[model samples]
Target: MCGTHGDHGRTVPPAGEGLRIVVVGKGGVGKSTLSALLARQLSRRGLGVVAVDADEQRNLAATLGVDLATVESIVPVSEDADYVEEKTGARPGGGASGMLRLNPDTSDLVDRLSVPAPDGVRLVVMGGVLRSGGGCLCPETALIAAAVAGMRLHDDDVVVMDTHAGVEHFGRALARGFDTAIVVVEPTFNAVQVGVESARMAAELGIDTLHLAINRSRSAADVERVLAYVDRLGGFQFCSTTVLPFDEVVLTCEPEVGTLMDGSPLADATVGLADGVLAGNRRPAGSVT
Candidate 1:
């Protein structure tokens, strides 16, 4: 069942077709893992899924059961200098010194840049943000934001974006237009703090539906500790919460979500989370707005 409170009376629309989600969190909190699993789960239900890897780690393709050779060959939008210039009219190396298109037409980016994955899911990689001392990556960022905003989805399509770790992506508003954000965290102080910050930022971006995904929970006590920390932080609210158990199979597997057996703990919990995401009654909470 969804860990949702019914105190808030008004309900947001259920996540039927065209549901968009962004999975975010601190490093090593399993954001990519959750995103891949959720996409596959929805795909299994006969929904068209587009998995976006906006993370610097570049792990979504492999996690979605894409072959290693294709994963390695992917050229992220941020790193593809030629494509960047063609779309944005400014080279990434040129930085902000030259004039660039603030809003480029990225209508075909999703279809043109995406690679096919298992179960008919398409994968798009946004590449990494600029490194330290590198001049501004404004054009690159704009391209990504525009591309996300322009992705054409059919009635049965869903987008699952795996964002980079930490709060930097929020500053750029790369996740703008996403309907829901699933903040993943482990039962640790720093991780919980990051989750709180991420949740706050997601609300700021106008993403109203939020879910807290507690990964690698050893016991009920661990899950409770995380909830207590979120209460203490006190600025955001989660419409639903999911607790994924600590399973060694997650570690032994080849980092592929499909490799996890059907009845396994993580896989089962992820399917349940997908169900909650699709049908849960989402009510606006006092704190998040």
Candidate 2:
């Protein structure tokens, strides 16, 4: 059954209030992988989790071993083109307007497109929005935004969104739906730049809760450097400074869509990070000690 919405339009589960955690960062920084790991860890703890893949690339579901066939079968929220036109007031072939017009029955489409993971984890893959002549909001984008809002209202145990690397997803109405935002960055100049831009966008969007996750590190020193950069950027704090070791196992296991919780080194780090983030502890590395 479809969940109900709150006064604020966020989805909230009937049993317990869920956390909306979003993973954002530059490309090739393992943001998607970290998102999958976080979902696996939370599910292992017996919490109901829904992982939303807002990226057009559509890799989050695949990483968790969810088949495309199953994903394409979930029912979406809505399918009324006229309703979309009324809500967004987008033109038929305008840029954002045209995009918003595509797939008017978004809720129904997403419900049909969602795939289920092994341990009761749900995967919603939102394809990219194509810009036409007008600046119409993409229907997929609108659907995700509405879904996030609906999830917040229902209080679904945990809503984890794996966003695209470029911060493009953060610009539209969807950015308003997230409660907490986590930026993933590697130890590189370009990655840092992306992180900075992401942070700026998060702040601009009035996101009250924000955190940084440092992925793919070789040593403790690398972790520290990433932390230092985050500090220098100012405004953002480190929720969990987890160092994901460069593991060839991740690549080898990709074909199987194995999760980090499969007893791998990366999985351990991811789990630890998820625990700290969920607990609302934003201390620097070793401060808990």
Candidate 3:
């Protein structure tokens, strides 16, 4: 069931279609894992899915199970001097201040730059700009923001953004036009606080369908306990606070070796969370503005 409340005007696309989603939360809260699995699930259903790795870690490709050979040479678009320069005109490397295409036409870059991923999912890597020195933030961030927000996905296409941790990096460009944001949180107070703050920042950036997922959840009681905290926040009730159990399979598997190793409860829970996130996007026929 969707843990949704309030008047979000978002509407779910018909069968064979998907909306945008940005998975974010505290570090080690499983955002990358969820992003990869969710994209894979959508693609397995024959949907067009794009997995955007906007985190500084740039490890999302590995989690999505992209060929290790491909990961070894992967460079984030934000740091790709040629591609970033071709599209934005502001080059990478040396400090790129001055004027920039804050609203560039980045329509074709998504397909051109993304690499072929498993399950028919395409991957786009975008590293963080905040840590790029405040002076270096403008040009890199402008191009990245335009690409993330301006790319128009097909009816059955889903774009999943695995964003950097915390609220410091939630800018308007990346959050715009996305249908939902699932903030993954562990069963702890500090993590929940980060989720709440992220949700708040995402809302301010115009993303309305905010939700939570309990990563590495231990039991039904633990899941419910987290739900209680989400409820106390009032405005930020999760769309469906799905639980990803702490399974041994995930713990033991080497990330570089494989993803979703055979069968994983965490993977199963992620698939359900994807469905719930989509369910929350559906508005009554007449409710959409």
lDDT of 3 at 253: 59
By lDDT, the best candidate is: 1
- Cα lDDT tens digits for candidate 2, 2-36: 01112222223234456777888999898888888
Model 1 backbone overlap count = 0
Residue 256's lDDT in candidate 2: 35
Clashes of each: 0, 50, 2
lDDT of 1 by residue, 133-247 (tens): 1234467876777777677777678899997788777754465667678889999989999998988777777766677788999998888788788877874567767888888
Candidate 3, residues 1-289, lDDT tens digits: the string is 1224444444455444357788889888888877887888878877788899888888888888887899988877888877777767778753445566667788886678898888888999887674542224456777887788777677778888887777666655567667688888988877888888888777767676776778888877777666667666653644555778877777665463145634677777777677667667443211211
Lowest lDDT 10-mer window, candidate 2? 1-10
Best by TM-score: 1
Instruction: Score residue 253 of candidate 2 by CA lDDT.
Output: 74
Q: Give the candidate order by descending lDDT.
A: 1, 3, 2
The per-residue C-alpha lDDT of model 2 at residue 56 equals: 68
